[model samples]
Target: SFDVGGKEAPKVQLTKDGKEVKFTSVEGTRHVYSIAEVKPEHQGVYKLTAKNKTSSEETTVTLNVTGMYIIQ
Candidate 1:
């Protein structure tokens, strides 16, 4: 989620591994990105960019998929 204060809402873009990713929701100044199921291929870097007429800001996150375990 992100906050870009003011009347006009900023445009939010999310990318995963250099490819554009779909956003789940965008309410007010908040943006949400959701992946239904996480897989090995889904493990990578993610970037979020918030832009407006005036200024823009960005952030990056890295996700590592070491292993998955099921408890019986």
Candidate 2:
């Protein structure tokens, strides 16, 4: 996260089912680091939290997993 002013969403933390995920860097005043990686078990709601020193905002996305049941 950027510790500088005039920068909103200084850091974007991406998580999948309470686990970290990879994300590309967006335009920003300075360089930012990646949060982490999403584990295999992390299959569900994906939440993204962007925040600065001031206030913070949040967003979430749903992800459903499926399996194949082929009959012979």
Candidate 3:
């Protein structure tokens, strides 16, 4: 989740491993992104960017998913 405050709302975008990704967004006082389910394929570096006419900002996070282990 992120808080965006400025004279004008910036355009928000999310990407995975440099590729655009589709996600559910809840916009209000705060911006929240949601992914219903997570799988191995979903693990990657994610980037979030907010851009406006005046300026732009961005952040990145790395997601690592390990395989489940079972014991007898």
Structural similarity to truth (TM-score) of each candidate: 0.76, 0.54, 0.83
Which runs of model 1 end up more than 4 angstroms from their true locations? 69-72
In candidate 3, what are the lDDT values of residues 1-72, reduced to their tens digit?
777667788888789999987646646536676666788998999998889899999999899989889998
Off by over 4 Å in 2: 1-6, 24-42, 67-72
Q: Which ten residues in a row have the lowest lDDT in candidate 3?
A: 22-31
Ranking by TM-score: 3, 1, 2
> Number of clashing residue pairs in every model?
0, 1, 0
User: What tens-digit string does per-residue lDDT give for candidate 1 at 1-72?
Assistant: 555565556777899989999878877776777778887888999998877888888899999877778999
Residue pairs in steric clash, candidate 2?
20-37
Please report how far candidate 2 places residue 49 from its true position, in Å.
0.3
Per-residue lDDT of candidate 2, residues 1-72 (tens digit): 332334454566777778877655545444344436544454578777767788777777775546657999
Instruction: Provide the lowest-lDDT 10-residue window in model 2.
Output: 1-10
